[model samples]
Target: MDGDLRGLLPDDAQTRQEPKLMHPFKNFQLNNAIFAAIWLVFLAAVLVQVYLGAGYSARDKVWMTACVAVFSAFYFWAFGSMESHPSGWSQFSRAMLRWAVLLVIALASVPVIKTGVISYAPYLAAMLGFSVPWRKSLPIVAATGVVGTLAVWFVAPEDLGWSSLVLFATPFLLVAVGVFSQYDVSRYQLQHELDLAQQRENIATDVHDLLGHSLTVINLKSEVARRALHNNAEQAEKELKEIAELSRLALAEVRATVTQMRTPTFAGEVQGARRALETKGITAHLPERLTPAGEHETVFSWCLRELTTNVVRHSGANTCWVSVNADKLQVTDDGSGFSTDTVQNREGGLAGLRERVEAAGGRLIVRREHGLTRVLITMSGDSELMRDGAVVQEASE
Candidate 1:
C-alpha cells in the first residue's frame, strides 16, 4: 500500500490494544489460501490460452512460462506485504514497486500472450484500488479497461465481442471488492479506537470516584484525630486506625478498578457514605443492610457513592438523605444549595458519575427543591445494563 491507501488502513499501534476476539480479520491478514487460489485460477486460464494459441514455437512457450513465473512471484510479494505487519514507508514502497513490475510484465508479454495478457487487467486494477487513493485509482483502472478493450478489438478482432464486455466489467467489479474491503478494515479500525477510548474513560472514572471518596473521609478523620490527640488519646488512636484501614481498602479497590474485576454494591456505598458524612459532622439517613439489588447495582452503587461525596464536600446543611429502589436512586442534602447548571458543569466526581450513568443507558437529573440540593437517577431496565444477576421485582405499596 502507498501513502494514500495506507491512511485508510490500520497500523500496528492502532490494533495493539484491540481485543483479538472482537476483530474480524483472521490472524490480522488477508486470507492467504483464498487469494492464492484466485491467482492460480487466472494463471491457469492464461497458460491454457498460450498452450493452444497457433504459431507459437516450443521455445516461445518456454519464455512465456518464465514471464508468468516471474510475474506470479512479484504479485504475491506485493500482497504478502500486507500480512500482519509493522508496515512502514519502505514496505509500502516495495509493494508499489512490485505492482509496477507486474504491469511491465503484462505489457511486455503482449507479443506472445497477445490479447490474453489483457486478463491481467483485473488483478492490476484491484491492486491499484487497494494500494492508492480511490480518486487516483478510478481513472487509472478505467484506462486499463480502455486499453484492454482496444487490445481485444485491434490485437485480436476475431475475439472482440463478449470478451471486451467481460474484460471491462471484471476490473470494476474487482475494484468494488477492494472498496468493500476498505470499508470492513475501516470499521475494524474505528471499533478498536472506540474500545480503547472506553477503556481509558472507565479507568479515569473508577480512579476519580475511588480516590475522591476515600481521601475525603481520610481528610476529615485526620482533622478529628488532630483535635483529640492531646485531650483524648483513645479517640485519636481510633481515628488513626480507621484512616489506616481506609487507605488499605482504597488501594485494593484501585487495583480492582484498573483490572476491571470489582464493582461497588449499594450496601458498600451505604456504609462508606455514612462514614464519610458522619466524619464531616453531618447526619446521614442511610439504608439498613445490603440487599441483592437489581440488575444495575453497579450504576446504583456508583450513584449513591458519588452523590454522597458531593453532599459532604459541597452541601453545608446538617442532614443528608439517600434512598434507593429498582427504578431510581435519589440523594438530597439540606446544605448550601447548588444551581442546576453547576451540576451539569461540576468537575471531578459528579461529572464522571454523569458520564457513567448516561453510558449505562440511565439518566442523572439534578435540581434544588425546598432548599435541598436534589439528585435523582432514573435507571433504565434494559437487559444490556444488567451486570450479574436477574432483575428483582419490587411489590407495589
Candidate 2:
C-alpha cells in the first residue's frame, strides 16, 4: 500500500533523471543571484554613508566608493554570463574571484568606510554562504569574524569598550544558517530522482507483459477464424467475434500497461504461448498444473515464449517433449538440427537468453545429437520453471 502511494506521488528525485532545470548549476545560479542582489543593495547603503556620514575622510571615501562600484558591476556581469552558459569551473573561479576581490576591497576600506567595526563582516557571510560548500564557507566566514574583531580593537575610537565583540560575532550566525539550509535542499532533490526511476522501470515491465500476451491471443483467434472459414461459417463467425473481443481487451490492457496499473501473470503467459503454438500447427506440451515462485515468473515466462517460437521456426521436427521439475525445465525435439554456428548466425538470441537466465542465477544448455535437438534449462535459487515443448512439421527450408 505504501509503495502504491509512493507510485501515485511524483516519483522520488533520486531515481529519475531530472530535467536540466533541476540541475545543480541551475540551483547555484539562483542562490548566487539572490546573494549578489542583496550585496549590491548593501554596498549602495555603504556608499550613502561614505558621502553623507562624517565618519570617513573625504579622499578616502571617494576611493572606497569607486572600488565598491567597480566590484559590484563585475559581480553582476560574471553571474549573468554564467547563468546564460553555466560551466562548473568557470562559475567556481568567478565566484572565488568575486568574493576575494570584494573581501580585499572591504579590508582596505575598513578605516575609511566609517561603518561599525563589524558591518562588512555580514556581507562576507552572505556571499560565501550562498556560493561555496559549507566546509569551505564556514572557515572563510570565521576568519572574516576574526579580522572584524582585530579591526575594532586597532581602528575603532579607543573610548568604545570590550563589549564590542558582540558586533563581530553576530553575522557568522546568519552565514551558518544559509549553508545548512542549502545542504538540506540538495538532499531533498536527490531523493526525488530515485523515486522517479523506479516508477519508469515498473511501467516498462508492465507494458512488455501486456503487449506480449494480448498480441499472442489476437494472433491465435485470427488463425482459428481463418481455418474455420472453409469448414463451417457459423464456427468461423464465432471465432471472429472472439477475436474482436480479444482485440478490445488487448487495447484496454495496453492502456492499463501504459499507466502501470496492471501486469501479466504466469497463467496468462502460458496460455498465450500455448495458443500461439496451436495456431502455427506446432504441438505444444505445457504442464496442466504449474505455479511460478514470486517475481521470477515474469522473467522466466518470457523465456518460455522465445524458446517455443524458436523451436517452431528453426527446428524441422514433428514430435517434442517439455518437462518441468521443481527448479528447472527442459525442451527436446526430434529434428535435423543445425550446429551452434548456425544458431549464432541467427542474431545471438541464445547468447542473450543465457545472460538473462544467468542473471537470475539459472543455467541454460543447448545441444543437438542423434537427429534430436535438446535445450536443458535449469533455474536454482528458489525460482519456479516454465517451459514449452514444440515440434515443427513443415518449413520453407
- Write down the lDDT of every candidate, Cα atoms only: 0.70, 0.61
Model 1: lowest-lDDT 10 consecutive positions:
388-397
Best by lDDT: 1
- lDDT per residue for candidate 1 within 149-265, as digits (tens), equals 776887678888766656678778777777787776566556545645777798999999999999999999999999999999999999999999999999999998887634665
Candidate 2 per-residue lDDT, tens place, 106-192, comes to: 667656654342455665566566566777777777776665556656666572354244444555676677778677656544544
Q: After superposition, how far is residue 68 of candidate 1 from its true place, in Å?
A: 1.6
The C-alpha RMSD of each candidate to the native structure, in angstroms, is 21.9, 25.8
Q: Which is the leading candidate under TM-score?
A: 1
Off by over 4 Å in 1: 1-34, 83-87, 90-95, 131-133, 150-163, 261-397
What clash pairs does model 1 have? 316-336, 317-335
Residue 156 Cα positional deviation in candidate 2, in Å, after optimal superposition: 6.0
TM-score of each: 0.54, 0.43
